[model samples]
Target: MDYASLKQKLQAFERQLDATLAALPSRQWASSSALRIASELYEIGAFKNSGTDRAEYLDYGYAILASHFVAGEVGYQADISREADLRQLIADLSFASHYYMIREYLYYSYNVPESMSWSFGEGRVEIRFSDKSIPRQFFTVYNDQMLGSQSHFRNFNHSAEIIRLLENEPEGVVTPNFETADPLMRAEADLKLAAYFSLIAPDSQIDLGGYSYAQFLNVYRMLLTKALYHRYLARAQDAVGAIYMPEGQLLDGIAGELGISLDIGRRILKDLVFDLDAAANRVDATYFSLMREGEPGGRIVMRPHHFATAEGLVNMLRVIAQRRPQTFLDRVSNEIGRAFVQRVKAAWEAEGFTCLSEVSLRDFDPKLPDIDLLVISCEPTLGYIIHVCELKCPVPPRWAKDQLKVLNKDSVSKAFRQVEVLQRFLRTEAGVQFLARVLPKEGHPHFRDFVVALNHLIITSDNAGMFFGAETTRAINFRTLERLLSRSDGDMALIQHILSTYDEHADEALVTTMVEFQLGSLTVAYEGVTASPLLEFPQGSWRSSPDRQAMVDAFIADGAHPFDVLELHPPDVVVNDHSIRVTADEEVPKK
Candidate 1:
């Protein structure tokens, strides 16, 4: 058959099934609830049949033995649940569920709670079909026009069969949009299933004994949102794999395809290994509480803010000191030392730089104008320093904005181009500095440590070890870029003349270029660390030769500190030098 003809055949076959359901002379579906019961289990989890070691099929229980399973004594369920098999567990759990179409005397059908079902005489029916997931239709149609899918099966062969079946189905009214009409089907299912399992739920079931349908749905929806978020965090990689589905969009995709939220939806995506998920234990639900009140995303605080400037802003700290320093000096030494290491790890990972070795912070100078980050790239190969990163609760901007900028996942071909385009940027001076502030570290304790420890566990040889490289993006530390550049220092001609746009209004000193040499060059080139005649520049906006010359002369002559001086401190009020304070509060307090 031609393509169109094939589609017709499929439609016709569906109609035949619908017709068969309609024509049963006895017409008993409501009481035979096994079909309804079995249908829902497929949506949530797997089921093993009690009658045999084989798994139960939805077709067998939901359709073939619908009446016997839901109403006429589901013996297989009892047999299975007692001993604990998949089929038995499904039967016991699905007992009161609305998924089945049980046969009363004849025609009525009622839906199980989560999906649209109706009372057909005394029977129940659920949204089910063999060809696809409901998302296939729901997503493709409503995707852009969720409301436009009403005519979905108008031309479908099964539509006619369903019409025939419902025609005989007396208790229920013939309708196509029952699901959209009630909209509570899925929520009801979540609640009902949760409640049923609650009896045996390792911990407990969320209660809904006397709640109204609306009430049950409302509470269940929120709980489901949380639970879905949990699922996303739990297995983000599996979640990410779903992005290619027809129904997948940012926020709506998760609920439409997977019946959940997108925040969790994207997290589940394969390309990522969410450190936030790892930072805390799963059962703790730390993300929920952190995010429940405020916005879902976090603010981007520059490095110096938390460690040096805004001490009060950073909180929720869990500090660890292996040994106690009973004396004041001992205490100060112990705490700051531990804290710096912790900060180093957070900073290292925040920017996505992998530590290739246990490069000691012993070489660091806290008094240096900038915090140091060590990596394999860049000059000064003995070490490269990225400025310290401040922890921005929820997430730092380096992590947050880059994450938000992600459009979607691509396969191998696109991945190659993406890696290629990005490497070019990373190789540049601008890109290297950005890497210092932006990337996240992937493998930990560095390559030196991992390789040495590899034989201890025979780890690097395992297939599982390869999985990490595939799943997670290896980190990009500026130091690593620096090292790469150090090797090719002579060949970096492409980037030599091209300058990157730094925020003109920002302080040159505070603006981290990561590399000491690069930053120093910029300062010398600009003459002053802060922008001159700030309003004069508009996108690399500069003055005419005479005007620029005049401005340069003025800047050179201005002795103490040039420019507005407001740009020197992290904030405008604080000045670069103690002598230029406009206000007492802005001055650094004396120790």
Candidate 2:
């Protein structure tokens, strides 16, 4: 449409979009945090350090056009250094997408309708309001938590720190706005839970139809505990993936997420916090270059791993070691060299065998060093090393050649004839046969009896399908087996029976049954809320703390994005967004 026409249409649409948005269900916005993002551009205005250029105006061009984006990806950038313009662009987007939740939850109310959705340009959000928008059954659950007043929206003092901090952003940002938005934490969960009160969730009987709120909360948390990030579990249900989640697919050219805690990643027993399909779509979209990338003046030079090549992996590992000194402590969160050690160990363990996450090929002639995935299965007759295989997640990293040289120079395959890596190695009968050289990597970890120890140490498994062109093998490491058995398989699915549940991290928390003791008993008017009947959550959930943490971190003053921590209600702490969006004030004074 022409500017005048486009302007006219969008303006009318804006009014409608706003009113309609105010009327839609929380599930809709919760469904695609990116969908409602248009409202920010069309109504609230996004940021761009690039002055007033179309390139910048259109920075969020992709998001404006695309229907949704992964929640975590809202601040995506290709680099973080020397891109004030791009950083501002990110600041603008964050402010608008999470600006402020008018309703946040499906609190029963009169003005609110059954459900609604709004689209500005190609983007749109379909919110399902609480059924009938009745005042009591469900929507009224959190009226006390709604934004204090609409006047709060009048003169939006968008955080300068937020604007300054977002000036230069890099690609694949992974931050959650938790550290800065603390006081308003409960508000965060409210925004997401808003959809629950909306009308999307089916009116099911098992939502403890006649149970007390306390009783219903218990079952609710239990269902959520069972599904969040339960990929194998998700495989069984027809739910959609989350928009903001990182999936099984590896990413290229991205920085580690900001403000996220171990709890944010490891604490999720289930992702039943929001709509499954929308969640899936949001997360699945993370496989591309979205938003303002390579604009003039505003350049972002990302860490090597963000680009995802063999060399990039090496460099990222190096950076990780330089930056995170304590990574050596944990198998899962270790950085760089140690991370690689952990990775190799984990990969080898995926195959069948009793092995440590780390191995020393010194025990055997050929050491399988500097490899991505190693698979092997053992049979007493065939020998201790029955089968051997190696695999890698190929993302076409930029530094592939340099790292390759470092690897080939040492070439464990050469030193130890039996050792092998990649396509050439696994194709051979010896590869299929698996029993190659040995290494001296046993009992490195301080702890004992992890899945890494039980299943992978004994055997190697491969599903060549994991890569573009490869053979067929899938190992049964204790961890992998546990994951498999935890969820429903195709055959057993129809039976509605399960042998056991598989916890992703397999941490003490799951065993502790932390969720069961919390909101397990609370009840809600399932007919009124938009939550999925497929799962449930506890009434007084311990997760509430973290869930609140996730929200409060993002909710800014007057619904504006907190570009930096200095601009927050309580400053002096952190000043970076997920993709490393640091503020000038947070930077050391220039010499």
Across 1-591, the per-residue lDDT of candidate 2 in tens digits comes to 234453454345335434532332221333233333332322212212233332223323323223332233333333223355334434444322321222222211112222222223333322333222221112221121122112223343333333233333322242343223222322322332332211112222221112222222333322222222122112223222222223211111111322223333221212212122324444211222212111222111111111111121222223222333254123212222343334445533543333433343433226345333343332111112222323221221112121122123332112222232323433333432222223223421221111111011111111111111111223222223223322222122211111122111111111110011011121111112222111111122222245644554445323532232223333112221212322222352211
- lDDT by residue (1-591, candidate 1, tens digit) is 244453454344335444544443223323223222333343223222233222222322223332232233223322212334444534433321111222210111111122212211222212222222111212221121211122222232332332233332222242453323223333433433432211112222222122122332333344343333222222322221101112133236345644545544343321111123322322111111111101124111111101111111111111111111143133233333343345445433443344332222222322222212333222111112222221111111111111222212321223323334433433344433443333234422212111000000000000111111222222222222222223332221211211111111112212211111111112101110111222111222222224645654565465322223323442212111222222213334332
**lDDT: worst 10-residue window of model 2:** 511-520
Worst lDDT run of 10 residues, candidate 1, spans 453-462
The TM-score leader among the candidates is 2
Backbone clashes for every candidate come to: 65, 130
What lDDT is obtained when candidate 1 is compared to the true structure? Answer: 0.25
Runs in model 2 deviating more than 4 A are: 1-61, 64-353, 356-467, 470-482, 485-591
Model 1 TM: 0.20
| TM-score for each model | 0.20, 0.23
